[model samples]
Target chain A: MQKIVPNISVDCVIFGFDFKQLNVLLVERKLQDEKTGETLIDDWTLTGYHIFEDEDFDTAAARILKGLSGLDNIYLEQFYAFGKVSRVDSPKDNIWLKHQHEGFSSRIVTVGYYSLIDNSTVTLQLQERNVKWFSITDLPELGFDHQEILNKALEKLRSKLRSEPIGFELLPEKFTLSQLQKLYEAILGTTYDRRNFRKKVLQMKYIIPLNEKQKAVKHKPAQLFIFSRDVYERTKRERFDFSI
Target chain B: MQKIVPNISVDCVIFGFDFKQLNVLLVERKLQDEKTGETLIDDWTLTGYHIFEDEDFDTAAARILKGLSGLDNIYLEQFYAFGKVSRVDSPKDNIWLKHQHEGFSSRIVTVGYYSLIDNSTVTLQLQERNVKWFSITDLPELGFDHQEILNKALEKLRSKLRSEPIGFELLPEKFTLSQLQKLYEAILGTTYDRRNFRKKVLQMKYIIPLNEKQKAVKHKPAQLFIFSRDVYERTKRERFDFSI
Candidate 1:
């Protein structure tokens, strides 16, 4: 007299910053409709998966990351869940529905998680067809509500960048203040006063000045700064209020 | 060549306030393992599903709500996505890995959404097994990281309750001040000085004094008060400091 449980799944939108633009990892869907047999889609989308009955959602996400990108132990955060009925559109009715015989019609609930990683370090396994990085500003038409999911993740990322040290995960270990400024500008999607940006960062007392300079640049070589370990550790437990 | 896309899903933690306790809806998973052939394990969890290939996550959530709970067009908020390597624990070796050949091995991402519903209006559809409510304070052991998901949802709910008229969703259309106060107490989970609580609520000007009284109460009949539509609408947009 037990009830049949619906399948659970996870999807991730991984964002990376490369000093110039923000990018997301995307993969093309391989499966075609049983009826239409159309394999081509408009644009690629983020990586995703189905949840096993015994596995935790977080674990499923990590497995997706490692399996697709060969990266493990990176920071991944859950952002949103989508559970609309008729979310899936197949050419045939009751075809996929037959897969799950439990009275419940065919439906899907996808949880969205995002992560910041050094895109350069990501060694793509490319198990399927194509795994590529798409510029956030120039993304093609995505499948499902992924565009909305990306937008939400970007909003969260921009908000978190101001308060948390999440930017470091997207950037290289060492970076210049101008590079940092550009990162903020790209995320905020607005040009910031360079002096004001530098002043605010300096006042925070968390950007440790490194005795290093950019090797090659057209303009003046700016001094490099690594995030202050002490301040990051202290603020790890402290809530950030970046209400400027 | 086209790419293979993993399926997407969404799960909801519908929270309800019963004036004295915080409650969430839970359903028992009915499917038995194809391999183990064992009956139900002690894994009770949230209601969830996969995102259809054609639909968005939000739409999917609304569909599940109607099909499972018989509620339509309720307020639902997307909270987080759960993506981890080991989130799903099945008898098979990482459900995705076991099905690695079918392109289904790729990780599944699930988006978590929550809604605040008036429990009184909810007519539980008995299509599934047990659709029961459990007090947040006294929830039995759950499957996967659902407990953590509920915790995070509660955190968001508590923060939202402080600044918005979320309590109205849990209360009857026409209610008494004491009843509204009880809702606050349930959400806050702390004792408040009745006089102070009343003072703060009155000062907010969101509750309208009705020319009616509670019927058949053991003690003094409390005056009925309707939530002021105008004030609630306006204050919802203006953020209120709720640090207390």
Candidate 2:
């Protein structure tokens, strides 16, 4: 029997990019009535579970993600914790939790984590699970305050992308400037002037231009670039600007 | 009788700037033996408590801070959640919790919030309580996992100051460029070139030069400056740079 913390849970909003749009990994949860043993509701939820009795929150988030989707070693940053009394107010969600355990606690404090996935490798494992990736532009009605959680995750992702180079986590190792621009636009939900964006990005020393180009393309191939972590580490400044 | 969540706690690391140094607010906790009623241990701890049953994490944090230090309306940002099984591994902390309540559970998931206190106004209220501010450079032996929690809070504060203008929260409304520089140096624990710092700061349109000058100082009075939130908001960009 798995010993779990009754009052605490961890949810992960896993984001991925596919050269065009950013998507989130979500699991389909089917709820059933305890007495009838019949399906009561079916909806999507950010992959999550109550923490093990002896596990820390980070460990619990990683364990839950691995258990649900078979994704290992994927770093998850805890961005927020949702503890509103009304988090599980929906009748169906309340009933579902009560049915899941003998004496389930409805008042759960969920630690929210946002993770970025390198889609090229994790796609195969995700395809084998009972999970699906939904674009941030179009999302289904999520269960148990998950819509709010996912929205907060996207907001955090946008803010993080503005200050950090985490956007590279979602793109291919070797990508074109247009692909990079589209990934930012999709996540940020705005279009940038192509030339200006390219100029700004090219000025960044860490983005190294590879002596390579896209193959088998109808249009003229664009130069490929790679994000060098070593250069970023060396050149990063401990800067505090008046950019509130 | 106060109803509280047995498994969830909220800790606030309240930081303040005293012109020359960064300080943190902490409470002195004296634990006694349950059976003997004799003091068993005495140590300092971050101001915190198990949240009330009907409250959210933010509400709980604010309530705890208000109840303990008479501080109100101070915004506390949730920086991290600590949920290690051994967070209360110290025998004294375990004994203290047991003494505080009957049948108390030791496995607590603490949501950590870092609050910046504008020392000028809140200092008087804090003087009446058991709480005291300690310099970040010289801290006492903290109880439970509080030292770790406080360290993490400082790390968060440093990183936040590096990107966001939260340093203003720790400064006086009217401050000189030297004071601002000192505030950054005190928190970041690094000195900056005076000319470069002033040049970079003057270029920022938000930090406006006031027609005011320092009074009653040991050295020559410096020109005062004020952080203009309106200007910052109006001129802020949604630009994502490859800094790291």
Candidate 3:
């Protein structure tokens, strides 16, 4: 007898920064099913896989990240579970039909996780066919309900960035204030007044001004600031009421 | 070819109030393993079922609530997903392992939802065998990981009860201030100074006095209050911060 097991899986939307734009790691699908045999489809999708019977959700998420990005020791957070019956459509059927399943049909529940990583540390060793990074704002049409998943992840990222110092994950160990502000703008998808933003940052008392400045730039190099873990923890514990 | 499908399911922990204590609904298991012909142990568990392939998570949650509680149009929120591998120990090892190529190892992921309802409305219809309500503080040992699930749900309910007017769900449509305070005390699992608690309630400006008193009480009946939805919404939208 074949045991029918409810399949659990985890999908990670790893967001990285390239100093100019926020990008996400995606993989292209190689359609080999009979319905889409030899069909040249250029669909990019988030890196995900079925949870093995022995694996936990967090373990599955970590394994997927390690296999796809070749990075370890990264922080990942479980955000939401997607259980829409028709989230994954077969290639032969209409794209919209993917989100509709018949009575008691096959179902896949995906737990979404978001991770912030420095693209510079991402080794392309696990780069299989069609693996690439695209600017989050310029993402092409992706397979399944990945677009919705990405949108949710982006929303969580923005909310977290507003109250938390998660932007450090997207920056180098040492960075200038301009680069940090640019990263914030990319994630928030809006611009802030530079002077006002700087004033707010200084008031937060978490960003420490270093004596060093960036070496390269046509204009005068701006001083760099490093995030203080001590102050970050203190601010988080004290719960200062600041809103963006 | 036989199609193998994973069963999706939702379980709800319906919290109710009885003036002084918080209660949850539970049902005893009845299925017996065909091979052993032994009665499925007298293990009480939450009401749950496999999801129809086409149903959304919320839809499935509501369906379960209606089926078990005989109440519709109640408020339910999804809390956590229980996906442990050994959540269900196989009861049919002797029967299925003899002929089955793949053993009875199956993974079931259950999404937990918590609902608040007036205990008076829970018409105990279609109770299988040993269905009953247990006080949250006096719960018996439950089967599976239900104990952990209940703890998590209780935590969410307690945190939400402070900021939102969810206590109204536990109380009757019209309730005295003492009744409301009792619900909060039960949920918070602590005692509060009556005068201070009353002061805080007055400051909120949402709980309006109904100019009525309880008919049966040892002491002079306290004034009744009805939760104002408009004021609650406006307060929640503006400066809504609760930490307890």
Best by DockQ: 2
Please state the i-RMS of candidate 3.
6.6
- Output the better candidate (2/3) by lDDT: 2
Q: Rank the candidates by lDDT, best first.
A: 2, 3, 1
For residues A1-244, what per-residue lDDT tens digits would candidate 3 score against the true structure?
A: 2222345568899999999899999887645435656564557789887776677777788888998878887878776678887777565324323323322224567889998888898886556467888998788888778999999899767756665578888887888888888998888877778998777777767788999998868999989888887777765532212111
Whose lDDT is greatest here? 2
DockQ-based CAPRI category assigned to the predicted complex of candidate 3? incorrect
Q: Supply the TM-score of chain A against the true chain A for every candidate structure.
A: 0.81, 0.89, 0.84
**10 residues in a row with least lDDT, candidate 3 chain A:** A235-244
Candidate number of the best TM-score: 2
lDDT of each: 0.69, 0.84, 0.74
Stretches of candidate 1 above 4 Å error? A1-10, A27-42, A48-60, A63-70, A83-110, A122-131, A143-149, A155-164, A203-207, A228-233, A236-244, B1-12, B17-73, B78-113, B118-146, B158-244
Off by over 4 Å in 3: A1-8, A17-23, A28-43, A90-106, A124-140, A154-244, B1-7, B29-40, B90-105, B158-168, B175-185, B188-220, B223-244
Q: What DockQ values do the models have? A: 0.14, 0.55, 0.17
How far is A27's C-alpha from truth in model 3 (Å)?
A: 3.6
lDDT per residue as tens, model 1, B1-244: 3232354557788887676777899986444556987654545688776555556667777877777789997878877666554555554424323543545434455567888887889889988487789998888767656777788778777755654566777777788777777777777776667887777777666777888888887989988877776776665432111111
| Alpha-carbon deviation at B224 in model 2, angstroms | 4.5
* Worst lDDT 10-window in candidate 1 chain B: B235-244
Q: Name the candidate, 1 or 2, with the larger lDDT value.
A: 2
| lDDT tens readout by residue for model 2, A99-136 | 67655576888999988877766743454436888888
